[model samples]
Target: MTYRLKYGTGTEAVHDAMPSIESEQLSLALAAACEDPIGATEVYGEDDGVMRTLVTEHAIAVLLVGRITKTVTVLQLSYTG
Candidate 1:
């Protein structure tokens, strides 16, 4: 299974605040979530980019390096599975 952000379909405002790297990480995280919707983690923001993280069933944690940015603040996040 694969999950991807429904980009190019939403208002331009979302993209306006998201950096390229953040978008990439968001996409990857979305995909990972599809494989395991129950997965959840605390995501961090940096240099204007987002990151990907997941908590496995074993209670282990995995984090993926994401983009960095200086602009584009994340106002809110709505999780959907």
Candidate 2:
């Protein structure tokens, strides 16, 4: 099943965060993650913790790992070039 996606203020910030060398690497990694997270095998971390990254042409996606009841939800959706 597909997870319901939600956007947080911080996530929104990522959209305008601008592209950097690091973000470029992250973008590619995230795209691979979206295809096969387990197979992607690249780990990314933030101050809070580590989460899976899923990249798309429209956005640089970050998957916050958590549970809301029985459903898996996307805590945020951010964009990059």
Candidate 3:
């Protein structure tokens, strides 16, 4: 189970999983480490890119890191399972 926000796929999922309430939403950033998404992270983004957050119904919070592609067109992401 891996979570990432690169080729817009991850971003789209996370962005569309944010809550309506402002305070209810939680946005976090990722650098060296990563947040696993096996059974955690539900909504993903539940909202627009304005506030990115990985929502989890089980009270787990995760922030996936995004990578830029060589063409600069997509954000490519990979995980070693």
Candidate 4:
């Protein structure tokens, strides 16, 4: 269910790849981060310059859960496999 936003998967640098995470996957990714909000996150305020990690069984993705939109706003993802 977790949509993995792979960074530096290939020869390209992480900065070069345009993350292609979807809505459903975004939700799943967020769910994953929520699993361990305390350990996996270093964010506060819930929005406006906040960030969190969406934890999952096999993968983890970093996203910004915007206060107003309530959606996966940003990505700083990497695969753990």
Q: Estimate each model's TM-score.
A: 0.34, 0.38, 0.21, 0.38
Cα displacement (angstroms), candidate 3, residue 68, comes to 18
Q: Which residue ranges in model 4 land beyond 4 Å of their true spot?
A: 1-49
Q: Taking the tens digit of each residue's C-alpha lDDT, what string does model 4 give over 3-23? A: 323333341243234344543
Q: How accurate is candidate 4 locally (lDDT)?
A: 0.45
Write one digit per residue (lDDT tens) for candidate 3, span 10-70: 6434434545442133233231123433222333355332223333232233333332211
Clashes (N, CA, C under 3 Å) per candidate = 4, 2, 12, 4
Model 2, residue 61: distance off in Å is 8.7
* Residue range with the least summed lDDT across 10 consecutive positions in model 1: 65-74
In model 2, where do residues sit more than 4 Å from their true spots?
1-9, 42-81
lDDT of 1 by residue, 38-72 (tens): 34345544422144444332222223332222212
TM-score of 3: 0.21
Error of 2 at 56 (Å): 16
- lDDT value, residue 57 of candidate 2: 55
lDDT of each: 0.38, 0.49, 0.31, 0.45
Clash pairs, candidate 2, are 30-55, 31-55
